[model samples]
Target chain A: MNLEDYKGIWIFVEYTEDKISELTFELLGIGRRLADKLKVELSSVILGHNIKCDLNLLFHYGSDKIYKLDNKHLEVYRTIPFTDALEYLVNKYRPEVLILPATSIGKDLAPRLACRLETGLSADCTELDIGPDGNLIQKKPSYSENDYITILTPNHRPQMITIRSKIFTPQTPDPNRTGKIIEEHLELNESENWTKILEIIEEDQEDANIQEAEIIVSVGRGIKKPENLGLIKKLSSCINASIGASRSIVDLGWISHYHQVGLTGKTVKPKIYIACGISGAVHHIIGMKSSDFIIAINKDPEAPIFQVADIGIIGDLFEIIPILIDKLTIK
Target chain B: MKIIVCIKQVPETNNIDFNPSDLTINRSHVNGIINPFDLNAIEEAVRIKEKFDDVTISVISMGPPSFEKTLKEALTYGLDSAYLISDKLFAGSDTFSTAYILAESIKAIGDFDLILCGKHAIDGETGQVGSEIAENLKIPQATNVKKIEFHENKKIIKVESDTENGYRVLEVKLPALITVNKEINVPRIPSFKDARKALKIPIIKWDLGKLKNIDKTKIGLTGSPTKVVNIEKFQKKKDTKFISGTPNEIVNELYQILKDKHVV
Candidate 1:
């Protein structure tokens, strides 16, 4: 385990539908800072089939170089093929640090890659920094926002961590910046492959995609009956806000898991997050704490949601939602 | 057919208590529950067993001896056997070491046709164990699986795996691993008869001594590559404006605030 043999910092670029994921750019944003601190070049690793995009966009975001692993088999995200390609790349190049997004695909690939490489990986990290001792310091919530554990891979080469999205602001794209693109090829054996994609079904785009919503009208256990979701839908429609829910209601089958807003679900940061009847647990709070403004309406004054809310209203959601809806509709 | 379902015992509540002195979970006073997602895995395994002929399911967990209680609860769901891999040396294992230990333990348990686990545990929520186990065993994996079906030949399995916006139907060969999502199935509760029977059934215990050819440096805290260097209580200040009034007044205040921000 010669740590010195590992050099540059690498961010695995992820793509969907011919577009690079926004989370990849976010990693590049933080990756730039860490690379500069460690005095190493930052690179982007992209694997796919016939990826038709301007590679300069990555350099614009901040990458000194791009490694392209283009193969027909690499087109789809199967765990083994993707992991095998990355394992080969990491072994050949020996990057000092590797960062990935904590998305569904990233979560699946990262652990498998780390295991094959025999390295360390931190998951869903909220923060990354270079320590005084020159180790990459990864900070993640230990079950709650109030408690955080700082992790480091002191002896491991190519330290790894999966970061959540929207945590950092991507740098403005610089047209003047350009980098070299390196094309790498590896032999992928079909016999070693164990999974085959039979079909893909993309759900219709619904107005309830709250991750990108500007305003969110979220409900919780306080909404009581499943029928009460109508009231929330009315408020959301009135304000043109997307609907979100705490895990409790989703667990109760009051709504689809798509609307769930919490740790196990999607993390959202809308401009206005109106939480109704939500006694926010720490798990739920970590997902939405970054919202620009939070308004919590709960009967219990001591609800944990109120602690983080900019505006705390004490009342029954059933009573208040109708009035609020009526008031907003009149104008 | 043989199946191995992996489970973890997590704090029953989200308000996890931490030891003030060491920043470790203060497990002394906390009640544990089978991780909610693992229950889904158990249910999925049970459904598979019910659908197949001569299928046997065994549940395994790597934790303190107290975890045997949770494993016993799994048996009430009609699992064939339970294995507990516990040792003082396994304490403070990160996901890497934890997965290594489980893979070795699984090897000791002999061969299986399939492996199942929860998407992730709530306590740590790393979600790395299942994938890492597959990697160690050199098998393929599908995560966030919503539905699964064995082929007529019973050698290839097809599943509906969840993605961000949609789902994909994938066909995985036998001897694969999968981590199931909560949407997979509704877990059943143990009946009184099964509960009583489970209490009498003995759970197999395995320690380092039971696992042959085990590497000493790859099973515990010292073997873990990633180290927790520091832990601190997070603090954030918010100047909350508590609104007090009638429903109409509250609505008026909120409307004004939203209007100022052009939210309406």
Candidate 2:
């Protein structure tokens, strides 16, 4: 397992219903950095049915070589056939590092590939870097809601890591850039696999994915009464923002589980995130730490949320939100 | 049918504190329990076992020997058998290495129809190990499964998976891996019968030697492809500006500040 024997960094480009997940491109953004750090070629392993049109997008996202696995078996992302194709390619090329987006399919596929290869894989990594010794150092929040743990697999081969979505900014696609495309052929029959995707029923699209929202007004425990949420909602509506909440508010049943934001909750990187009376815990921080601008409105000045906020208002949210709404209407 | 549910002992996050000097967590004050998601998986296994009276559920985990506390906790939940994979040599494994060891251990146990795991470990959230185990063993896997049903005659499994937008139905065969979500089922508290039996049963403990053909290179830090090159504790900046006024006055002042900041 000499590091030198591994030559390229590979991204598992995932797609569903013929559309690529945004997480795939986000991984490319981060993968480009790792590729640059290691001074190796950055490539992508695209497995899907009729993905000829998708190959160009891989190069635009910094892949030097696109290893395309096109077959009907890969059409719906079944585990057995998809893993077999990926394992075949890995054994042939022997990539030094493999990166996958922590999407549902990627999460399921990456670890299985690592097992077959008898290598190591790091899951849901928030941060990744190369050590001086050339080991891929992965930093993830550990202890099931505690502080961050830095893990290094000094002895592993073809280091594997799955990164969460929105943690890395996607690099702008450069249409002018060009790369080599190498298509791999699968040797297995589709009928032999044990799993088959019978149907894919699409859900109604919600407008409230926190990562895409420009403005977010989040409620915490400090709102006092659950009825007080109307005031916060009115304020959010006035600003054309979505409403979010810390885990405490959700646990208290003030809001639905979908509104909760934290490590176990949804990770939001909104441009403007307003915290109402939420005492910032590390679990909550990991979810919203990437926000472009953070505003904390808590009566306690010493609350941890204030530490990460660009603007700190040491006042009760109940008293402040209505006034803020009124003032916005004036303009 | 036999099912294996893998669980991990994790520090309860609600009470964790950071020691500033070393950037490590202060675990002394924290309580440990089975990871919440893993608990959901264990509960699902129990439900499936109950449906098929002949089924047996085995709970397995890989951590420090002290993590046996979590296996006992699983017993209280009605798991029929328990095993702990612990060795000083297995330290510092990334998800890849973790899956490698777990897959090897599963192989040693033999003849399991289904494997269950949490969608992602709360601490790492990498969600890579379960799928990796399926890959290592070359089995089918469905993740973020909210609902799972087995069709006995056809040997097909109907799984409802959580997608970015909604749910999708997938059909996989037995000897597969399924990672469940918290929405699947409410885990039951252990009955007195199971609780007492759990206390009486001894959990099987294994070291690296029990696994067959384990390439040491792929079992620990050596087999891992990733490493943490460096760590810098997140530093929080102090805010100097504090607005103090009567409640009404403070509201007005906040209004003005919001206007100035264009946050309204």
TM-score for every candidate vs. truth? 0.96, 0.89
Which has the greatest lDDT?
A: 1
Residue A34, candidate 1: alpha-carbon lDDT:
89
**What is the alpha-carbon lDDT of model 1 when measured against the actual structure?**
0.88
- Give the per-residue lDDT digits (tens) of candidate 1, residues B115-155: 99999998789999999999999888999999989899998
Scored by Cα lDDT, where does model 2 land? Answer: 0.79
For model 1 chain A, the run of ten residues with the poorest summed lDDT: A140-149
Superposed on all Cα atoms, model 1 deviates from the true structure by an RMSD in Å of 2.4
Q: How far off is each candidate at the interface, as Cα RMSD in Å? A: 3.1, 3.3
| RMSD (Å) of each candidate, 1 decimal | 2.4, 3.1
DockQ of each: 0.62, 0.50
Error of 2 at B28 (Å): 2.8
Error of 1 at B37 (Å): 1.1
